[model samples]
Target: MLLCFVDESDQGDFHGFAGLMADEHATKAITDSLNRTMRQVAVDWGIPATTELHGHPIFHNKEDWKHVPTRVRVGVFHKVFEAIVAEDVVILLRWVHVTRLAERQARNFYPVNFPPEQVCFQHILQRAQQVSATRDTYTLIIADDRHDRDRHRERFATYQTEGTPGVYMQTNLDRLLDTVHFAPSHMSRMLQAADMLAFIYRRVHTVTESDPRASREMAKLWNTLVDSGRVHNEGNWP
Candidate 1:
């Protein structure tokens, strides 16, 4: 079985859906490695050892991130990225620029009621099925719990039963397991990694347009995932 840990970044101008897919056998090792890296980074930075690693704060300079020195902050970020890349994992992402989506809706080119979250989930489900097919294994999606947990769960159930409409040519219901699981970010290191991936990709595409240094740093990480042939993107809608 393959376990896919999913998370999203909906801040600022871009929204991103990303997940880390790893074999069930390797999941523990990957998460442990991530935990170790995070703990070590905290120790090195002289922060509380129990502090949780959150991508938004670390990348966007919020919360605990503001307390850490710039070099330490960047170091932790790179270390976490390296930990995931070193493991046997596949990163999956679907990003959308909200402004462009809104513009498309305003022009009647896209459905007004079809929110970016829905589009992102549909793409993730499709990708999960594809990954499951190639691996000849079943996939269980474990996503970061959100305020809209009930709604998201209901949607997943609907998709499992009815299949996704107006998105894929045909509904894929075989490879993915019926139920979607949710967990808090701090509870799962894999989820933390997923959060980082989504946040980094969204930040790179949305917020760094004019900042060359920021763009270079973000793009370097983003491109590494892109070159791995495991990450996928669903471009903006018409």
Candidate 2:
């Protein structure tokens, strides 16, 4: 069985969905290693073990994140990235430029107005289906539980039963997802990894327009993912 951990990073202007797909047996080991590395970093920074390691706070320097020394923060960021890269994980991402989407809506490009979240979800599902077919294995999707969990669940159920509104015949639900599950991000290290990757992709794509340092760091991370051949991006809008 393949376990896919999914998360989203929606920064108003930029919205992205990311997933980490790995074999079910290897997922626990990967999460444990990540948690251990993060805990060690936290201890070195004098932060409590219970503290969450979110991407924005660690990379963008928010809240108590400022307490971590710059060098240590960068070290932890790279360490986490490297650890994730070292694992037998495949990264999949779907990015939507909200402004571009709004423009398309104004032009009436779509018969039905689809939310960015839904668009991202659909793309991820498509990718999941392709992966499942290629590996000939069942795939389970686990997403970070959000306030709109019920809404997402309802949408997913509809997709499974009726497919998407505009192109019902195009989506093959039966072969795609075995199930969709939700869990709190704090409780799932895999979900946390998805959050970081999504955050990095969003920040690198949008914030690089303004921040030089972010531009540099994002370039580095982007190169690492691309060069490793384990990451894929769907529908990146300029």
Candidate 3:
């Protein structure tokens, strides 16, 4: 079976001690690219294109999507996702968060809250572990790491040194799974979609950083959906 896994990171604008600073331009660009890919997928699947075709933004919540589940909302990957899940694949949408912290403490993870980046990654790894325990399939990770691959690698390395298990440390998952790396270029459909989403957020925050009123509103929206765990959902066990 082939599973098309999708993940999002830093949608709320909290980047390594950085506050709710969303890059709207990057987000918009990536959102558009994702929509284009979704459109193609929809057409290929013979699905009717409604006015809401690829209409949702890359970063959205239940408030934005009605047909899909909380975790897999309607967005760039929706078309192919809808088609594939019915047959040979299971679509897993893992949303990653990044935020501020006093230091790297693993114990403070369980009952995690918003504004903590490392904890979110830990939770993801934990979920992955649970998935592996029950399922016989492999996990494939398709990521957009053009901007901070090296930094992420270094961080992962440190985590390994500290005996912390993360997605990168999934040798068991790797045995059943393969990691597909896509460059954030105009060539790859997935990368293009990711770029559109990233660019949209980048532009929005860049131009409106100083306006506390608007920033506060965006932050509230982000925290309400993503940070509050309202949009985070898991699949049933086998």
User: For residues 1-238, could you state the per-residue lDDT of candidate 3 as single tens digits?
Assistant: 2222222334453321111111234334434544565565456544333213221343343222344443333333333222222232222223332322423233466343333444443344334434444455443334444564565455445443454554343333331233334343434443333333333333344346466754564454333324333222332111
Clashes of 1: 0
Poorest stretch of ten by lDDT in candidate 1: 229-238
Summarize candidate 1's per-residue lDDT along 1-238 as a digit string, tens digits: 8888999887765677887888865688767876787677677766665566787787666776777776666666777777677777778878666778778678876544577887777778788788778778888889999888888888787877887766553565578786788899887878888888877867766674576766677777777776667664445443
Tell me the whole-model lDDT of each prediction, alpha carbons only: 0.75, 0.77, 0.36
Q: Which whole-number lDDT from 0 to 100 does residue 104 have in model 1?
A: 68
Candidate 1's displacement at residue 7, Å, is: 1.1
Candidate 1 vs candidate 2: the TM-score winner is 2
lDDT of 2 by residue, 1-238 (tens): 7888899988877788998888865687777777787788677877776666688888767776787877677666676677788877789988878888778877976667777787777788777767777778878889998788788778777877877556423565556564578998888878888888898877776664566765676688777788887885455542
What lDDT is obtained when candidate 3 is compared to the true structure?
Answer: 0.36
Off by over 4 Å in 3: 1-4, 9-81, 91-117, 157-162, 165-182, 185-238
TM-score of each: 0.87, 0.89, 0.38
lDDT of the structure predicted as candidate 2: 0.77
Query: After superposing candidate 2, which stretches have Cα over 4 Å from the reference?
Result: 167-169, 176-179, 209-214
**What are the runs in model 1 whose C-alpha is more than 4 Å off?**
99-112, 167-169, 209-212
lDDT of 3 at 146: 56
State which candidate has the highest TM-score. 2
Q: Clashing pairs in model 1?
A: none
